[model samples]
Target: MSAERYEYVPHHLLRRRVRDIASGVEGELMAVINENVSDSPLREHWVELAHIRGASGREFTTAAANVVPA
Candidate 1:
């Protein structure tokens, strides 16, 4: 059997304006969460954003691939 491999992509998204392609919501990137699996070579990139909507300044997390510079 062959092992699966994935390429590591670097992202500098902190404090930058980004938009979620799936949700159509734009906000300032607040944090980046990296999740490492012990059994796999894959690393998941999770991003947190602020000021999604309204005056409350809501925040949410989603896959990094869903976000793009706005």
Candidate 2:
């Protein structure tokens, strides 16, 4: 980081994002929610999913393991 490498937004000032629909922006936070497998009978499939999806997924199992489901 260097002051000499300046560009537009040249001098900083904080700005809040307008979230209302009337403000031409969606008001809700967007996210991709993962499915809850805590009560599933086919919980083994979910653990396999964690492996197939690699490092970004649920890599660690809990203390109760299969008893607590996926």
Candidate number of the best TM-score: 1
Runs with alpha carbons beyond 4 Å of true place in candidate 2: 1-26, 41-70
Against the true structure, what is each candidate's TM-score? Answer: 0.54, 0.16
Candidate 1 residue-wise lDDT, 11-56, digit = tens: 6866778887878778877665544434533544333323223124
In angstroms, how far off is 46's CA in candidate 2?
8.4
lDDT assessment of candidate 1: 0.58
* Candidate number with greatest lDDT: 1
lDDT tens readout by residue for model 2, 24-48: 3221121212224444444422221
In Å, residue 19's CA in model 2 sits off its true spot by 11
**Looking at model 2, which ten-residue stretch has the lowest summed lDDT?**
45-54
